[model samples]
Target: MGANFISLSLTFAYLAQSFLFDTQVYPDVVQYQLAIEGQNHTIHLEKNRDLIGKDFTETHYTKDGKRVTTSTHE
Candidate 1:
């Protein structure tokens, strides 16, 4: 019983570590859409090319070629 418990604990720890630290799960661009007040809003997270590493650009836009807001983060 002790051996089985140790084995299970090791397996759980391995899985948790992989899930918490894995970088490959992230992508270059992610997008989401929402409807509020009968208008469509699109939010985007894109990898920034101007920076050296891992920076992101966030942009929000409407359906009719109108930009609502934009921001950048590292």
Candidate 2:
């Protein structure tokens, strides 16, 4: 019974630790713009490092979502 109690306590501790420090490694795009002229344009973005220390992605999509471009500055 003591062993079972210890195991349950360890389980709860592990669960608690997992919940406490969980964070998303994947950064998202914080800013974007779009202009669709009689076509379907969908832009999906992710993170790229900036010199001014702002967190935003350099990825861009154009030509009816058929092209992908990356830039140092948007």
Candidate 3:
């Protein structure tokens, strides 16, 4: 049982590390747009990153569904 536990723990740790590496090394490009009501009301967004690839963009819509806001991380 102890040997099995150690093997399972090692496998889990390796998998987690691999997942983190992939996400950090290969950042995903996300392009999203949304619109509601009116003829020309829309929100268009494209995420941009710096040299280190740490910047991220997030968009949020209000509960009333009348406004949209965007935020960035560094």
The RMSD of every model to the true structure, in order and in angstroms, is: 18.8, 21.5, 19.3
State the number of backbone clashes in model 3: 0
Question: Looking at model 3, which ten-residue stretch has the lowest summed lDDT?
Answer: 4-13
lDDT of 1 at 37: 53
Best by lDDT: 1
Give each model a TM-score.
Answer: 0.31, 0.20, 0.21
Ranking by TM-score: 1, 3, 2
lDDT of 2 by residue, 2-65 (tens): 3322111111212446556857443344223343443444455545555344343455677688
RMSD of 2: 21.5
Backbone clashes under 3 angstroms, per model:
0, 0, 0
What ranges in model 2 sit over 4 Å off?
A: 1-35, 50-74
lDDT, candidates in the order shown: 0.53, 0.43, 0.41
Measured by TM-score, the strongest candidate is: 1
Angstrom error of the Cα, residue 13, model 1: value is 32
lDDT of 3: 0.41
What would the per-residue lDDT of candidate 3 be over residues 1-74, giving only the tens digit for each residue? 33322111111223555677675553233323333332333333333545333355566767878666454553
The pairs that clash in candidate 1 are: none
